[model samples]
Target: MGFMDRLFAREERASVEDPRVPISSPNIIAFLGLDALSASGETVTIDSALGVPAIWAAVNFLPGTLAGLPLHLYKRTSAGRERVTGGLATILHDAVNPGMSSFDWRMYMFGQVFTEGRGVSFIERNAGGKPLNIWPLDPCGVTVKRFEGRKLYEYKDGSSRKVTYEASEVIDIPFMLKRDMLGHRSPILTNKDVIGLAQAVTKYGSKFFQNGGVPPFAIEGPFQSAGALQRSAEDLAAAVQKAAKENRLALSLPAGHTIKQLGADPEKSQLVELQRFIIEQIARIYSLPPTFLQDLTHGTFSNTEQQDLHFVKHTMRRWIQQFEQEVNLKLFGRVNNRQYVEMNVDGLLRGDFKARMEGYAKGIQNAILKPNEARRRENLPDDPEGDKLLIQGATAPLGSQPARGIGDNGGPPLNDNEGNDDAA
Candidate 1:
């Protein structure tokens, strides 16, 4: 007999009235998604929420308490049970299974056993006319089968059938309640502890360095790249000095103060000096050679002074373009053919400057050797033959020995003045 029947039997033995007798379990209660197949080959689906309150009422109350209870009492008292069953049905509906109808039997039986005090021992019976007793004596020991597929339910009388449940459905009815449900609480780390953890990470990272090298900032200036030291005051001064020498700017005075003192007058006394300083600064900053600057602005200036000023302005454009183009190449990683053409133009100007300088040096040599009015007018030198003779003497090869000294004489003395002179 089921637990409800046993309670009813006990109530009868006590001779008390049955309060729930007038109202059948089906009329006062309903089960969501509940289905059953009877021996008559008829299937019933219980769709109402209150259709099966008897299962819960029977479990929660004593037998005589509900035996004569009114239908209204079942309706009002069944709210909590209805809520739980509705939630269970919703879980079943969302579960991974063919349909809730397939698992309706298991859900219904489980809900009944859960609400009613009947354990799995009474629910699961073996074929040998004995109870399976799957429910443990200790509440914590009870095992729950998470129904994933069709599980077979068998009776002690050897009746068996396949019962399927939705795999996604979960019934979390605990056998017992306790203070610590699972285990002790875990400890949490504080902010100070986290900082210590970060420090540990940095310490370990330090050990991984194979060379045991000092930090980069600890190295001296000369050890670093030229680019790294470019912004230093010493480097800037050196660059200015080198640029001044290459451009032939007179460095007898400091270039910086000279440019500032010259102001804007192109015809002023110090203007030419200022222009030279500016030109040198431009060439150094842009890394362009000075010859390239001079040839681009020919000799259009009215005087040597104006020529220096003109050269500074003319060269500034070329140097700026070249420096800007190089910067662009680094920034964008490319330069077009047009930019190369511009650079070639500057290079041609530089070549022309070199040729002019060579011709000027030759003229100076001619003037030095023959300083006479008539030779200057003819662009000729008075001692041209002397110069030719000097060139010929420089190219001539020495004989094996020199003419002998006045008396002693083999073929010649090897130590004659012609060979022995230190200058020779």
Candidate 2:
């Protein structure tokens, strides 16, 4: 009956009607088409996420490095695996098709993988089932589904006609698969909050500098009326702008006023530290080390070297394996495939001449690699004599005794000198 009692009764009825907690959950927001916003009030999509330098660096570095590596197709043989040439090998190593180079095609595929979380390529084959060319497909326009106990790809090629591809016809690589295995999770979308925060910090820094390195502040003054206070504030703001434009360090204010900073400066707010932390977070998302992203704030000579090894071993190896397996399965076949593709990660050591030479020397000396093989790795023309495996001959069994000359081995003795002496 009373106003307060009526309000309380209505609230109880509303709560009972809508018992669901978190009225504005992320899923709900997404359903309502409003979930692109992050807690830092920034929009995080693939394009916006790439605007962050660290993210851009990561996306480019991964695909670029992978694309530049030596890719070869090998066939199983009686003695060992031998490099295959001419058909798919030439396509994979030299060019994906007559138009695009292998590096460009691979880079395009992996760029899609990094940004959209999936990469798809259609394998065009001749009548005899020999692959003629590999064509890159836009992951954004492709939809994947499990149909009739098999995976199928429905690609929209900017036309009303949707082309359907069998799982065997496409080389599909996903950053991470969902529960259904048909869907994938994007690194940017899954970790948008962290990227959003990075964007916010970057925007803040830009704005701070844009206003002539001035932080937000308030003026505390003795005022007689609201209008006077307003006028004084406007005049003070104009003066500040003018001083900034003239590159003047000192600011003049009225007698009764003092400027109070509204927020902590960048250093006090730990902006640099936050930025470094953000780089680490992004690195974790990509399984890359901060050093790979050129974050050398904490890098030392020894640790940087270790980071390089970590990148090749931990980060790059997994991606290489995934890509190799995918291409091999689609291009060759899943079962009893004699031919396969491989990326020679040894190219990463090309820059470190000493390390590379030492590794090659060890491989050659241990008979694991022929001298010509090592020379080939260095892109040098091979010599005919360097084709054989070479190893050091100094090593022997611990108990073995040295073999002396004929006098010690029960062979012919040097009897002339001793016999002549006895006769004399």
Candidate 3:
């Protein structure tokens, strides 16, 4: 049987039971589309937040880059650490289960983390406690609570009944935990106002352009009634649209009415600048550089490279460490487990040929990495002579070599006293 089938195989086959009472209500606001109403009068949920291009770019970039990096499992040994193969390693590095590749699973999990604020997974193990497979769980369907000092995960598994998993059985990672530790704070909910403003600005720009670059205006004339005034306004709007469509430079209005702009135009209100500022704000939310979001207004070659370093060190490293620790704790015990999973963040440099080659050269020359190992990184076939550590011959210990004369076959010159005594 598959992991899920075996997990629920023991439950009764009768009618589905009622869901167990959780410690508190599940955090389903993101999925339910009820996060919060922003100051711009827009409802900010996961969907609305993502509708903003900057937010979408940030979310997609973070999760995509992170998931695409290499993930491997390694075992600690007497000589050193070596990568583990087969079994759990295969599940982690290659595929989580038969139905899911490791990259897709990680992308899904991190996507939820960025949008819904939490990502969860369940570990399926054989009889000997050796992990067999890993299965992802929807955060919206899972509720966490502490009972009798132990944390429990109650998941709604598509039945009327809720399946319970101990903390040890679940792998949980939250963007940021609430004070209760049971609930997580979503990025969408936390920064709804900023994202809402972005949406409002985008919508306003679209509407403004849709009206043929004509801002809303006030029609001034001596009208007999409100009906007359409304009709005049509509007529004026239609004339403006017709003129725009016809590529006419002049808009023909009624004899006595004049069009007076009601509000500031996009240029006057600095719409472009506002949109750029919004992108910067979203970047801050994700701890990303604006350059990564395709904002190059202020990007320079030097600073852009610095931003890349910042992303790896300040942003991506934190998530990588968090995921590593969570998987380590879940897959192995806290105590004496020698096996653990690691994400190779250095994989990001794969696209930079110069950087990759330089790093490999340094590693091989310093004997920090075997030549075969460096070649393996580039997917090159290993040579028999490349398996050993290599270093420069000039790097030998200072006192290890004897002093040599300039022209004595690398030995001290013949002693003059001995040669002269024999001659005397």
Which candidate gets the maximum TM-score versus the true structure?
3
Candidate 3 has which clashing residue pairs, if any? Answer: none
Per-candidate Cα lDDT values, in order, are: 0.30, 0.81, 0.82
The per-residue C-alpha lDDT of model 3 at residue 323 equals 95
Candidate 1: regions farther than 4 A off: 1-315, 318-342, 345-414, 417-424
In terms of lDDT, model 1 sits at 0.30
The residue-level lDDT of candidate 1 at 138 comes to 16
| Clash totals in order | 13, 0, 0
User: What is the alpha-carbon lDDT of model 3 when measured against the actual structure?
Assistant: 0.82
lDDT tens digits, residues 1-424, model 2?
Answer: 8775653342210112332311211222333445678889998878888999999999999999999999998989998899988877899999998899999998998898888788889989889998899999877667675554567777766666678799999999898887756677777877889999999999999988766788988889898999998998888777777878889888888798999988889989899999999999999999998998999998999999888888998989999999998888787676855888899987685658897889888998999999988888878999989989889987999968454455675766455554355565
* Native RMSD of candidate 3 (Å): 6.9
Per-residue alpha-carbon lDDT of model 3 for 42-158, expressed as tens digits? 878787788999989988999999999889989999998999888888888889989999999999999999998889999998899988888999887787766655678878866
Residue pairs in collision within model 2:
none
Best by lDDT: 3
* Lowest lDDT block of 10, candidate 2: 10-19
Candidates arranged by TM-score, highest first: 3, 2, 1
Question: In model 2, which regions exceed 4 Å deviation?
Answer: 1-34, 396-424
